[model samples]
Target: MSASNAQQYAETQIQQALVDGLLAEGFFDKVETEWFSAQEAESLIGQLPEYHQLVSDSAQRLWRWHYDAKAGLALVMLLRPGVTQAWEKVPGSRVLQQRQQGQALAWEALTPQRLIRAVYQGMNALTDTLDADELTAGQQVFLDALAVSEWQTASSVDHRVDTQRLLERSPAEFFAIMEQWASLLDRPYHPTAKAKEGMDEQEYRAYMAEFAQPVGLRWVAIPRERMLCGAGVAEGDQGPVAWVADEGLRQRLDAQLRERGLADSHVAIPVHPWQHQHALPKWLAEDFEAGHCVTLEVSDERWLPTSSLRSMAPVDGSAHYLKLPMAIYSLGASRYLPAVKMLNGDLSARLLHQARAKDTRLVEGLHLCDEGKWWAYMPPEATLFDEAPRHLSAMVRSYPQALLDDPSYRLIPMAALGTPLPEGGHHFFDDWLAQRGEAITAQTVSTLFGELCECFFDINLRMFRLGMLAEVHGQNAVLVWKDGRCDGLLLRDHDSLRIAVSRLEQHGMQDPCYRIKKGHSNTLYHDDLEALLFWMQTLAIQVNLSAIIDTLAGHYEIDAASLWQVMAQAIDTQIEAIPFEDEDRAMLREKLLNAPGWPYKLLIAPIIERAGGPGSMPFGKGETTNPFRQAGCAASHDRKIDTEENVAKESEALERKSLEREAQESVA
Candidate 1:
């Protein structure tokens, strides 16, 4: 990509996030006309080639934002559909200015900082609850996000990887390469998703997963009595720390421990080299001086990073994936590996294992990475929730040994499936199409997408029936491909499994005894089955599957709503096949298929509202028009007009606004 193209792409992304975040936070409801009909647009500015192209394209929509009525400053934006919000901005939009109604309209270039200021002024006029400082802080965050996005866009221009060569590699090799591709889009549609607030350019290139840079592991020796090990590792001699280190490295570690005169009482744990260089001395100075923690000189094993920057895979083809802590902030939260979270993940894994035993389908289809082996440093008076301790821990995520050894099975993270390759325009789907002797047409692509939905929803609904749901976001959910089909699902990062205690007992399962902080909210336990299903809707369907649909739609030139229709059909098929009580079936049908709106998780607004404070995963809630409704599926009950109706209403409003402005100009 050229420098100009990269800059344009980056600005487009930031603009989409700006409008989508406002819409999700109910800012659009405050404006009179938030869209422009084609007639209104052409009547005002004549028919432009780009405007016609945007309307002709099935994936794009033309929207108008009423920036300020008095200033005659309105933004004409081309947008696309988003599962979490009604519309997302597209590239090639222009801002319009007219001093009076009879005056000719002037078109100005759209920029991210300009949009950020407009949003700030709108917020200032909309609410009295927020003071100047809060609003200014929000503005600064948006600016920072824009700068970071520009950097990311410029940095990744040479990422045109070959898809055919990617398909020819071994399963493990392909998986790693896919992870590198996946790193290109972190959280799809998120504004500041790729911003590593702490790292500069050189550090970002050296440490980011997409760069595919080899990172060495730094060793730390803490007293054995103070070290906290997971249940699986505590009793075993051959655990993650042992498995990752070779005999030579182990000998070196032991010698260093003895020279420090603490060999008998201390054990060595691997640390991320960056973390050791930056975070350790800053946070562990007291411990080092008190002889409670010692840094070892031995470093070993070149490890490659996964999409999740903190996680690493051994270059020697080991299945033991290492997850370490880093001091950088992403998504408004520190990427720390606290023991409390690891313990909760262990409990969640145990429950999943129990569910697997109870359901035969899960037994055949559901797979989980073993996350039970971990180690953390705990001082004499320190608790599990301390901030410093979290930055110095590691967990070994072991893939199922059988699956790794099988040449027929390919483990691809769902993120990779959704992310379109820079060169090929599609991920493994093109490869799959070639293998199946099918042309890459709209119908064939939709058929392939339906098969994927069938496999994905099968595993998800089964777990839902068992009264639990994994956080199946794109990053955590791995689709197991066998031969040429999506065979199963493999889930990792199991800390936030949502469950209902009543539903669990009804299914002959027990609670996993999750730990929650004293005053913080308890999100793990849901009293309502609807709450549990929200995770299925938001993460599994909305985030994970919707991303893939968007990529497929763009790559194959198929309408996204057409693919969503396929999703609806697969969901209906699964709902009927899965054995559920009559009431449960009714609830699922009403909530998923018949509902006019689905729960939308607010992303950027919460960060703006947070004003750069520390928080657990930034989250807020709203509702969006159901994608099934947008796909033209019939609802069981009549609620309100669907997306098309909403568009028509906006169209009529735009016409009226235009006429009123003309009348005012005549008076002026």
Candidate 2:
């Protein structure tokens, strides 16, 4: 791609994020948009190349909104409007602003940085609490994201490796490559999705999963009495050593401990290299001065980062993947490892196991990573929710050994499937098409995607029936493919499990006593089933599958409506097959298929609202037009029309046959 193309693409993503967010968060309602018909904007459409294709139809409209009342207006074309409005190509890509006092407005191309600043200034007018510092910080983040995204897009063109070679290698290698591709596309539809705030360009290339660079662990020694160790963290630093298979590295780490003359009393905790260099010194200065924390220089073990940057897999192939704390902001939340979160993961895992045992479908279709082995530093006075303690913690997420060892089974993160290669094809779907002996047509791809939807929704709905829901978004949910079929789901990062206490009791299970910091809002337990299903509608369907649809439509030139129809059918099938109470089943049907809109997760507004406060994750909710309803209702209406036409044709044929018989009898 040319530099101009790369920059334009990055700016487009930022523009889409801003308009979609503004719409969902109801900013437009505060200051409504002014629209023009295609005929009215004929001259404007002829002048701009971007608007040429969008205004071909008479129904298309051009939208103008005065984000800044003093001088300017943002311009975009409206494609489709529902719960979430879909605009043509790049909304806000071009702005018509006044250049001089009482002068005619001229169109000016807007960069991502300027777009964010204009929107921020516009929003600041409506509210008194909007901070200048926060706006500056947000602008910097947007610029960082734009640069990183441009580099990623340029790199993706030549980054293709042989898919067969990856699959033929060890599971570790195959997963690493898949994750690298997945990392290329971050969370869908977010403004600053690619921003790694703390790292510079060099650190980003070195540390991000897309680069596939081997990362070395930094070991920190904390006295045993001061550390809070989980179940599998063995005594005398053996747990940390066990992650390293090499004997030489193990010996070096042990020697480093002994050389400090505190080997017997201290336990080792692996720290991210970036954290060790920047955050550790600042967060643990007192501990180092008091000799409570020791930083060792013996770094030998090498690992590869997965899509989730904090999680790392051993370079030498193992079931174990390490999760550590890195003090950086991504998606408006600090990526730190807190013990309270880990403990909740343990609790959620137990609940998952119990729910699986009760339902045979879950037993067949759901898999979980072993998040049992974890350790954190807890001083005598600090609580589980303390910020400082979270900076020094680790969790070992291990796959089932049997699943990993089996040659027929493959683990691919759903993000990999959702993110298409920049060179115009998807690696996973191409392989699937070849394996199935089918041609790459829209029908074939839709068929395969339908199967995936069936398996994915089956497991998710089963958990929903049992009053539990996993964060089945692309990153957390891994599709388990066995012998060319999407067989089951493998879930990791089990920290934020949503559940309904009443539903659990109906299935003969009790609540797993979860710990929450005092006075903090509790989002884990929901009183009503709709609250739990909100997660299903947003994360699983909207965020995860919608991204896949976008990629597939763009790559295969298939209509997105067709894919949404397939998904709606799959969801309908599952809701009926799963035996729910009559009332519950009706509710599911109404909310999922018949409802006018589904709950939309507001990503950007919530982050902006936070200004700069610490939290688990930033989220706000709004409603979006139900994609399922849009497709399903259209499909159903089409089928109805077809049936009526067939009946009319049959009646005409019968009438003609009767008339012919009557004429023959009269001649006789």
Candidate 3:
């Protein structure tokens, strides 16, 4: 597709995503393709007709903020369907959520505001009493989301279009096409890009793997006094720290240090170019003047950012991946990689490595991406309360050579499983299933899906039972596929590994590095037995598996309930046969399969209650009836639109506002 055609396609897809996202959030009950005449339409908001009621309904219900209503129908063009709703998985939902969606598509033309307003009309769902201050913060959150969205998919339109076109081909042809592309290039990215004003253009384009642009990492070094280092040295004769950059680069860096008469005083570190260019000038100014920090020119070797923006891999070949700190915010948390996390991430990997070494059963499909050495430099006068010197931190992580041995085997990030293919013919997994040489049948999908789900759950449970919990979101959970057949999962990223203190003790493992020493536990955040498993359970079940199930069920018309039965059976198999205690290992299985209202992390609620600064992690909690637990549930696992609940929620807000006004009047 030409750039123009790609933009057109992107506009449509982006619009579709917003509508679908809003629908999922309960903004509208249905979508209508046909537009009503101005006279025939009923009044919506401020005498706007029913045609405008879609936007009006979204706003009045607090599902949308009526920020840019001056432009009428053009507002609809800003969003595209990021993901098609599994109406099959969402009961009481009807949306004309197809290609070239939204009534705005019917419009003959749009103004320049098409991109600007669309991006500005951001989505940040609020579940709190909105005061002036709170409302301002929410708006900022929405704007930040808008800016991030704009930054993401702008340069990848052609790449996305290419993937979309190729997915329609046969499996062999698709495989060939993918081979032409970079490994891991065919990830199904959820289309959420928007054009927003005041958004800085992407500083680095190829940092996005989807772009497949070959780029080099920026390298730098700081002295020992200025830097905090966490290193894991294996049983070898090399230095204490494992460097992630090229060996040649390391040699050159060493030579440079020798030339400067600082050979023993300094060490090299890899840093995100964006951070180095933008953030470090101010943050590292003191260090540079004190002769503690020095920037080194990195030879341009191709690298690609993985699903997590902070981590990057060499495009050609490398034994270790470079994990750098980024200060940007995405997915509810600042993307900064704290030095503490970088160090602990490696230690966490070492712990897991030891576990796998002890039990060969844990070794099969599970490959621990060990992060060994991390380095960070903090500016003078920086305090604990200050945000982490994320701009100055870097870690070296082990790249699994074993998994890369077979060219036929592809390791895909779990989140990519359910996303719509770029250009659009089917979900990513559908194309994946085709590649697996499985006939595209309901039975095949269910059976294979069950296997995948079982593989994921088993790994998660087994980790918890062994006394560690890897925050098992799809980004960290990689699906290993050989010739399209689903094999076991490969887990990566160590920073989020929550170790249970008691369980680790029981397992005969103790590390002073993981303990609290001196002023506050910076690197250590141990979770109790229950909390240890919460991240795994919530992120995997609710966020990852549920998403995949929704897509497979909706897109393939496979029975969600049947899939649930498979999951239940898998859990039962683990429960009945596995040697682990019921309390720890089977906890996830019990909640998802049989318990009422499993503990769910309220992701949005915490974002709503914004506590300023580098504040402690904000998380919320709420419970919904576990769909998996329902007895005699039908063929589908669709969540019903909470009509009564929504009505009550909206009414209570209205009533509360009215009372607030009356109280203010009396005080006046």
Indicate which candidate wins on TM-score: 1
Q: Give each model's clash number.
A: 0, 1, 11
Give stretches of model 2 more than 4 Å off: 1-4, 69-78, 82-105, 125-166, 233-237, 632-668
Clashes of 2: 1
89-163 in candidate 3: lDDT tens per residue?
A: 112111221122344323233222243333333221222444312345644554455445533443455654245
User: What are the TM-scores, per candidate, against the unseen true structure?
Assistant: 0.90, 0.89, 0.70
> What are the per-residue Cα lDDT tens digits for candidate 1 across 275-357?
88888888888998888888888877579888889999878777888999988778777788888899999999889999999
The lDDT of each candidate is: 0.75, 0.74, 0.53
lDDT of 2 by residue, 103-146 (tens): 45456666556656666666666777765324555445445555
In terms of TM-score, which candidate is stronger, 2 or 3?
2
* Best prediction by lDDT: 1
Q: Model 1: clashing residue pairs?
A: none
What is residue 543's positional error in candidate 1, in angstroms?
Answer: 1.1
Please state the error at residue 124 of candidate 2 in Å: 3.6
Candidates sorted on lDDT, descending = 1, 2, 3
